[model samples]
Target: MIDKILNTRTILAVDDDPTNIHAVAGYLQPHGAKLLVANSGEKALEVLAQNIPDLIILDINMPGQSGIEVCRKIKQDTRLEQVPVLFLTGSVKDVSEAFAVGGVDYIVKPVRSEELLARVSTHIRLSQLVKSLDKANLLLESVNESLEMKVQERTLELVTVNKNLRIEIDERRRLQDKISYLSNYDFVTRMFNRNSMEQELKVVMETQSDADARSFLYYIDLDQFKIINDTCGHVAGDELLRQIAELLRGGFEFASICARMGGDEFAVLSQSLNLDDAIKRAHLIKDNIENHRFEWNEEVFKHSISMAVVEIDEGIDSVSHLLSIAERTCFESKRKGGGEVSIYNYSKDYIDKTQQQMKIIPLIHQAIEDNQFILYFQHICANNDSKLQKIEVLLRLQDESGKIKPPGHFIPVAERFHLITEIDKWVLKNTFKAISSLPENIIVSINLSGEFIIKSNAVELIRDLLLQHKVQPSRICFEITETSAISNIGATHRFMLELNETGCLFSLDDFGTGTSSYEYLKQLPVDFVKIDGMFVRDIENDEISRKMVESISGIARAKQIKVIAECVESEAALNIINNMGVDYYQGFVAHKPEPLMNLFTLVK
Candidate 1:
């Protein structure tokens, strides 16, 4: 049966003979396929250029371009390669030649309608199947690509989650460790608590016998700690305690046990040491405590540690006795102005000392109220010459008894009562008043406490004072320690710029004494760098100190700032500083701090 073909099938027939072309067209007309005819092979190639056909019918044994030539050309052209070709020929050799040029079939010259229609329909169905298979392959490729992308995204998400989980776990472990440490140790000092100390002490006692020699217990109470805490705030007091703990821990490596007993008290137990050796160790610890300077918020404080050492013997049965002996000795040290070390001797008479000195504090306060606070000026001179370039104003207090007390006597007490700011204000106002009265070119510098700088009104207060006195700001310098300037950089920078804009200069006092001196020097806007007294005092004999001064002096010169060598006590020290290119020197060798009235005579 010949199935009726649709217009979708397009067939092109090429023949040089007009009869052959007409016969093929007439036979395929009932199949409903669109037929295009060309009389020559050249004409067929031209027709192929205009339209793409699904099927081609070629007649061999024609003129010029033969059926084999047209078929070969059609198969070679990639655009026409998909079109199926059938050859119609009278000769068997011609039909074989047609098949060799990619023709699917060849029929005799008298063409049959049923056979032609069947072959054309079969090729059309095969072509449609090939196109459907190509589409399915493309769809599969798109699906594979989408699946790969989703897998990659999920892998990245899992990796990110794993990294976050590991970090969280590490943080949790660190937090747990910190919590355990805090629970078992003192937060301020990182030292064992009283309970830990007691447990260690029992173990120590069990291991020791009479043949092991006697052990000693020393209880340390920070003298004037209450005063420091009250005046400097609890933060400063805590810092002071922490520093003391560190110093004590470092100083006594042979001590069997050590712990912070509570508040400002600490206990140290030493084994296998005689009374003399123990006493010597206590003295060494005392010196380290008294000499060590603690910085709190840029303010430097020297603390006095009072020690009470008790020797434990076979006769002493109780730990409380040792604690009491140490406590009493500490009390005695406190009673005697609290800067010295004392030992507890059980054989000596116990001194029940109380109500012995209640009259001194009031007398001191009254003296300050009565305008008896004395000002002394110490000259800081140029190192290159013996010229007096600057003077450091020192405070002295005269009591009603006509006895003068140094700053060490009442400053701590005053600071405890939050009276230092008032004292500082008075100093500033009077110091400016004093400088206003000085010679035109002479510049006087005053040391400012950290508390003064922290005050919001500090810059304004200084500016107003200078304006009121009509004092040239260049002639008045404010000195701050390196520790102070670096502690609060933002506040310090604003204060420095504001005061510097008004021509008031800043001197970084004790410049090389701090850990952050270099950092502070870079960030602080200052006019002068004061070499600390420790370096200056030893510059004559200490090679390291001399080199440090020279290096710092050179740096200061490079920065276009003046350098002042403080505490120049000897001629040797003076010569060394002068050679180092130091701009100023201050010490007993230059001028001792004298009364303000006396400074006038000296300046002239």
Candidate 2:
């Protein structure tokens, strides 16, 4: 710092007399300024070449090159021109010439010590202030540039947020439309309702005017649906209906129309089928239904369906007539012990739910390959103390058209297809890439899939990733679902132990949702228990949920595990959780999940 301050105001003194230069140097060097002395103007230029002093002192009358000529040369060289020049001479007559040649001030020969020192001090201080002002200007420009960049980033974030909100609103509208549309069909089976089928049949019969215009109708009834429902309850029966609907949807041709006409009864319309094709479809549907097995509650149930086919010729003028004929034919098959596919003269056959779950499967693979996945972070902080802040990483997908999709759309499908492990790895890799830019005091927590933890070499992968990213393991926390961890306790326990050795912390997410949460909490090496939203969201209103949160918080506190309350959407919920000794609160009220690109602004 001394050198810096000293370097800021270096003064070069030039004269033919050593005594004169020595006197000048002696006066200025003691006043916290560096001094350079030259006995001639030629040597002064050499000194100037080596060090561009902030202030230059010149003698007007020199041997080789006069001070006027040297001052002319200094002014000609733009690099040296800015250094303030003070001239020393015997005559006051040279003062106008000195000023003309760019000399800023003059000190006469036989200089007084105080006058020379005072002038030198004045010029050097002014030069230093100018230099400081220039530096300040540059610094201000840099700060403005940084501010512009931050504003642009913030604008982009707001645009992204707005885009996501629009997508969400659009999704809700689409879901509502689907719900309203589904109302015309069976919700459990996702098949057309009896009214929809009858209306569709009416249209077909009325639209096709040819006397021989034909369609095939099939009536389907599950043979053992009642027995299964009675034995396994309605939940299992509903699941059975869904599975059968999928089979029927897949087994028939694309042109065929199928519906769940009523309980345990279904209908299919083949608008362009002859006796042979209709019979062939009936046999196929019959075989597929009998072979399919529905598993529920660890027990497997196999059931067969009876189907009857009726031909819709011009002879069938009414939708009711077609349905009645199909029903009677189906009853004949039911009388044959319910496994046969019966057919009326020139007859049809078949049977179909969550349409979105199927749609998301392809999107999951597309997203992973296209690098559409992105990271979002929600801040978790102490309720009373804002200093204690952390971020929980959340995953989102941006599709080809630039729509941001929340994880809820695709995560279930990914889990179903066992593609969640790959997605988890993608998240971990990207997260490590991002975390190094965060502030040292802010810790980041990433979620680990239970399946990935147990099935993959997750500990080794995470250790390698942390090392590769040059991130401290202590800065990261892994969140695990309580029920998932319990499902594969042995493997999950080992994974936690090995990773915990590397200083990674753990949080049991959705804490109170699982059975035996307290039992498993004792065994798992978790540092936090994130209270489930179900309990926290209504804690202020519902006594049972409030007690559940209290019990979980109490148990967690007893075990030395800090508790975090999630989905804290209101100040009341935050206050309630805070009063219960919960260590942290996270939800929309506190912070929304934002893209990690803005993490620098968030860092402490």
Candidate 3:
């Protein structure tokens, strides 16, 4: 840092004495200082015009101009004012005048080399320090101004970037919130959807045991909903549903989860309520809906709802099972009439009520042990003669109070628990014995469960029974529903083939109700195809139903197989079937189901 400031400095030696100039030049020449010799004041001024030196050594006894005059002239110019001057004097006579004109110090006599170099070096270093300080002050002011400008420009850019960043954060938060709402909430009713409700129930089931407070599920359906939609329009129907959703939301406390289960159906999962309280809540909702009047397009209409409440307890295996009970119970309410509330019952509290599968399992075991099972026979009459063609033996169970329950009441439980095969064995044994003495032309049909057909040694069992009772195999027809047969088609075909070799007949019951579209008939050895009752029951009034029945009958005839129309409850239905070329009919219109013993007397 020091070498840059005080490096290779020049010194001006102004003197009229030639010898003095030579001595001064020779003294500084050996050192690193550049020496300029000026013989007079005028000469020094000429030298100063072309170049500026670091320091000046002026002899007081000069010839042309006095040393003091020369120093004064040098100090007059502003550019040369800061240069340090050292006087070469014969005495201390003119040194004061030299100091007055910016003379820093003076040397006497010939100017010894040691004294001359020391004074020249000191003044050069001092002069350099002053010039560097002045340059720095000027540069500092310029840099400060530039720094202020940069800070202003950069600060503005940062503000803009920060604003945009905040906007992006807010937009992302809004998008995330919208996605969350759509996932968990139904857009139509602004309530929890089925997915959220199922998850909540699953959490409760998985995390808890039998809760001290009983939870209940209410399954609700609007009564005669189609009437409103057809007469008023779907717009009016949607508005009515919205109003009812709000009503349901307000009726229950915040504890319950209310949801719309699509269309005109809704459900509520109560947090905790006993059976009585749950029933009352369901009735309250039913009454509220029944009394609420909806005004649309200046026309006012009233509506009612049917509801079913099932307690959500540990007895239920899963959410689907609990919902199944609720659906059946609600359907039972509609079956009787709308504008009613029904509670799911376990035992004989309901003579023909919705039964829980778990509660009925033990009852089925008990029934099997105590011989509480019975057989009821419904007559299947031939079409052209309208005479008795056969009798279908229906399985029934007697409860503790002797009320007969149909297959719909307990068959699902029996099938699920693998007890259906046992029930089938009982039916086959009793049926074979009851008709042992009957005429050979009287064919008796017995329904077999899919589980029994797929897993049991059915062909050998039936063969043994046929030989034991001496009842002709041709008179005994085994009935398997289309849905059950489709589940195990190969097994069903094998069982039928083995039994067919023995002269026993196979009939596919409930045809046209499964996933198969008449393609399975050619695959199996079926003697008769019973058109599903769903189509036959509505054939008198519905064209679609009539078309379905007609097509099925045509296909059966094409295969050279007879078609049986089930659920022919009215003469209208029978007349329709007769026109369609149906061979036989089985329904209450022909004859109500009679006991197996009673049927024996009729045939005898």
**TM per candidate:** 0.42, 0.45, 0.43
Candidate 3's residue-wise lDDT over 388-439, tens digit each? 3588998889999989998888888777545688788788888898889777
All candidates' lDDT scores?
0.73, 0.78, 0.78
- The positional error of residue 74 in candidate 3, measured at the CA in angstroms, is 99
Q: For candidate 3, give the lDDT of residue 439.
A: 75
What is the clash count of model 3?
0
Candidates 2 and 3, the one with greater TM-score: 2
Q: Candidate 2: lDDT over CA atoms?
A: 0.78
Top candidate on TM-score is 2
Q: Model 1 over residues 200-299: C-alpha lDDT tens digits?
A: 6656556657664677777788876766765676567777888888888888775457788655778887764588888788888888888888776677
Per-candidate clashes come to 5, 0, 0
Model 1 alpha-carbon drift over 4 Å, by segment? 1-364, 384-389, 602-604
Return the lDDT, model 2, position 2.
32
